[model samples]
Target: MKLPYAEIEFDDTGERVHPGQVKDAASVISREKATDVIVICHGWNNTAAQARDLYTRVVESMHMVQGEVPGAASRRMVVIGVLWPSIQWADDVDSGAGAGVADEQETLQDMIRARIDDASVADRLVELVPRLEASSTAQEQFVALLRKTLPASTEGEDEAAFEMLATGDVGEVLSAAKGGTDAPDALAAAGGAAGIDPMGVAPLDDGGGAGFFDSIMGAGRNLLNLTTYYTMKERAGAVGRNGVAKALEALHDAAPDARLHLVGHSFGGRAVTAAALATSAKVSSLSLLQAAYSHFGMADDWDGTGKDGAFEKVPSRIDGPIIVTFTRNDKAVGVAYPIASRLARQIGAGLGDQQDPYGGIGRNGALKTAASLPAGTLLDVGGAYAFEAGRVSSLNGDAFISGHSDITGRQVAYAVLTAVATGRS
Candidate 1:
């Protein structure tokens, strides 16, 4: 089915806009004389079709909400779906199904060693090492190559010590390479030393060490996933800052007085905030639905630097209320987010403790932020929740939202409409 809203597709870099589409989208808003423009962004690992389906659900839900709220339909609305290439890895492959041979029962250490010695992975590394040696500024060149080779969603600075490997320090590089082979054992030993489970969970013995090996292999696979996850986070920030932000600036120039409302799902939350920070676009309302960004993104002061949180200064840019939703049912943010953040920190991503806390905005509301107005009010679905201007309202999404991808429910649509209507009023 066709979406009820206009759609604008952006390339992977978030810079190039599809020709004729923006003008057509602008025409729709102009024709309707739309007072409010709602832009929706999707999260990671979604195909274009999936994004469109999500937009469809959101539009339908908004229609339902408008039916219940009198005078809601009187406001001319123009909905736009921001389609950016934010996918990292395919869903099926990311499920850890074919990572290790099912029949081969190996310990966690053995599994790490196997991945380290993986012929395909090693071959790529071997090819990369020579290229590093052949180039000047070998470290930077190598990192650039890795940024190209790695399946991260965003491009970012290399903070990890992998650059040290290319500084004519063959011994250090070889030692680091060798350390990869010994990582599992070292990690397990450290865990044992700390009086923790070496297998990362309860000791499992399903005969022949099958269960133990499976657990170890799972952890190893998670490392790979962490790489992609961090990449996606950086990419989301880039797309928002560079691509979406620029686009919004241009749109505002064309329609200076137009009211803007941004709704981001998962990583899109980071993107929308980045867009706001990157531009002087005056936003009316910002809604983050199960955002997969740092919970401290809206903090007043983070890590003594005052500029640590991704959206710390977003309030200054927005002219109205900022609404955020949180739920414990989002497994991606609840379970995988902290693990990925911890691994990214270990690799020198320079992710601060506050910005890279154990929980996400999706699972927990904005935390450590003294500036939150009303301190994150929890709203009931279909209930009257008028958002106060220049404040943040954190709503509990457990009643209507179930998981990371369930933001298109009727209740959520109602809540979004409430925010929009309240901001416009």
Candidate 2:
């Protein structure tokens, strides 16, 4: 195939290759040095497309950083593009159950989040997924990997199964949708506030709790969790359990030097936490894109904790650094209101935070990233890739600034990728 995108390199004497082709070529990539392992996880109702197995952003981001720090890519590092079954979160919930044509740029951002441990440091993390005693299917392989790769001990509630989906009862949504209600409406009735308009059934009213948009931002913060596709939806006895067990068994037997780096987008972000809290998998870190705890169902707050609840159990178990990338102007965030409303709310909540990081998508369809950073820190990790974005695009053809997703978006991807690539957190 003809190679496009000059920035991407492929020694295709054997075959002209592109980034897409390089991403999934695990064997080819594995042959390279094992310096840093970066695994990317995708968001809800979606699966990481390991097809052809090439990570384009990994290459692009690496090159971008190398320009500043030199030798960023050549460093002993293994770029492992981890493809997990995610629920596939998207901006247009109008698409039937996340079965939508995805924007590559948005998807790529989510992938970036999963590769870093930022999501794992979520208020809480779930237990490692269980492995089945039989069947080494791709899903099962991952479960086994977690079982063997994580630490020997942990603490948390193992609310396994695609608990959230089951909670809403996919049957109910399908039944109502089949009965003629629009899919969004059906989903609202099942999982959101009464009269949700955007996603259909729930208005997601922020209530008097905070500025409607800002108070609801907690939802935006966790919106990425929706991107994960349902898998090991099986709990202890469910299909996911056995698959996890089998995978863990194999991992337990692997060479001790073997390490696992989890990157989950959207719902997958929560799953990664689950596996981490459950197994003795020797993991370097976790990255969450569009992250939210799966087991933590629809609730009154972002904390998503409850006494005797699985999520409550989860937070108490995993302790690590976590990074989250969210946009105040995210359409899905429903943040059309003024930022002042949110600012006041933050003050009311006693967060002691004072920054307007998300500049609304302006008239020309340009989105600005106005985030707050630690003193002397740019890019939230490495000042190399981060820029004070003002809705500008490197592409002139279609203005490919990027699309929306739980983890991936032009700005969000840059934030997460720069953080991880530079080993910030």
Candidate 3:
């Protein structure tokens, strides 16, 4: 079907858009004289087809909103859907594995072993196994081994390298090994008083020397999960900052006067925010639906200026409202996000406190940071509601929204369209 706005598809890497295609897309938007360009970013675990389906639904629902809201239909609109490699294989390790694997624990260990072997850390793993078995606290020993074996500096390496280790740089080195070259600095900056350990595992009972292997295996599994979680987080941020950010800049340059509205779900939230933060173009509205990014990402300042959240200065770039939707029903963000953040040592250490240093925007909205704006509005969107301009609005998306992937709902589309239509004036 012919879309109202020119449809542009980005690859998983978010880097390899054909020059001709880009020119064609720019021409389409420029020739259409679109006053408003809406960019949608999909979250994790979505294929290109799924992302397209979601974009279609959202655009259709926006049309419905236009039909209802006066003057909305008269506005010329352009839609851009961003598709990236947000899905991590480790996320589905437990569920995607075949039923034949009776032991999930063994499967997790095998996955970790494979990752280590793939990274040429098999010899290191072998060496650590004995240390892990010998140590009274297997978990601590395993963590130390990971810190010791992984490379400290990953300046230009394409793959994981264990060439050298730096003193007193365990977390940073391990972060770089798990994620990429940029991870060490990013992770180090994020480090502070550990909040809660979301995936905090208890040490197995010391069975003298008999249960040593079992203990090591458990610690291995936990370590693997933590490493994978952090890697995914860093990857998402990297894609947004590097690849997606460039694309958005190109789009902005093509249609400088166009009113920009961004919609991002799950990790796509991180992507869009990164794009906004990086771009000098003014954003009309930013809508985050079950955003998996830190709740304080858009804060003005956090923790006495030691380190800023991902989107700390985003408010200055946005000309209109910052809309955030959160629901307790989203298990992925509510449960998994915090745990992952804690495991990565991004937040203060326990399950989570009421303040929720590790909580996601999808679970808790902006929290303390929501008050940063004078006109900041927080509401429960159990029914139809209207949002004002130049404000940061947090909506309770319980009634209409189901969960993380529930971005295509009529209510959500209406909220987005309303935010755009209102901000245009």
**Predicted structure with the largest lDDT when compared to the true one:** 1
Q: Write the per-residue lDDT of candidate 3 for residues 1-425, one digit (tens) a residue.
A: 23455544555445645545555656777888888888788776546787788788878877766666544667888787776655433322222222222354445455556544235554455445544435545434456655543333322111122222223344443332222222444332332212112322211122232121123343354455444434445555666677666766777898788787888887788778877887666788888888876676766555564555556677667777778888765656643443343234443333322354656677668755643443223233233445655566787777767666777766787677767877556
Residue-wise C-alpha lDDT for candidate 2, range 1-425, written one tens digit per residue: 11111111212011213434333333333454244444453333332343112245534544444434523334444444333333233353221222212332233234335521335422111111111112224223322322232223322322222222223333332222221122244233432323223322223333432211111122222222221222222211121122222232233343233333445444344445455555554444444443433222211232334323233232222222233333322333222111111221211111101121111111111111112122121132233443222111111111222223423333334444444444322
Please estimate how well model 2 matches the true structure, expressed as its whole-model Cα lDDT: 0.30
**Sequence-dependent TM-score of model 2:** 0.41
Q: Per-residue lDDT tens digits of candidate 1, residues 53-136?
A: 888888887876776654466777888888877653312222233334442223223322332323554344334443332343
Give the Cα error of residue 59 in candidate 3, in Å: 2.6
Considering only N, C-alpha and C atoms within 3 Å, which residue pairs clash in candidate 3? 194-348, 194-349, 195-347, 195-348, 195-349, 196-348, 196-349, 196-350
Q: Which of the two candidates, 2 or 3, achieves a greater TM-score against the reference?
A: 3
Best first by TM-score, ranked: 1, 3, 2
TM-score attained by model 1: 0.72
Whole-model lDDT values for every prediction? 0.58, 0.30, 0.57
Candidates ranked by lDDT: 1, 3, 2
TM-score of each predicted structure versus truth? 0.72, 0.41, 0.68
Clashes of 2: 91
Which regions of candidate 1 deviate over 4 angstroms?
1-4, 88-214, 304-307, 340-356, 374-380
Residue 326 in candidate 3 has what lDDT? 80
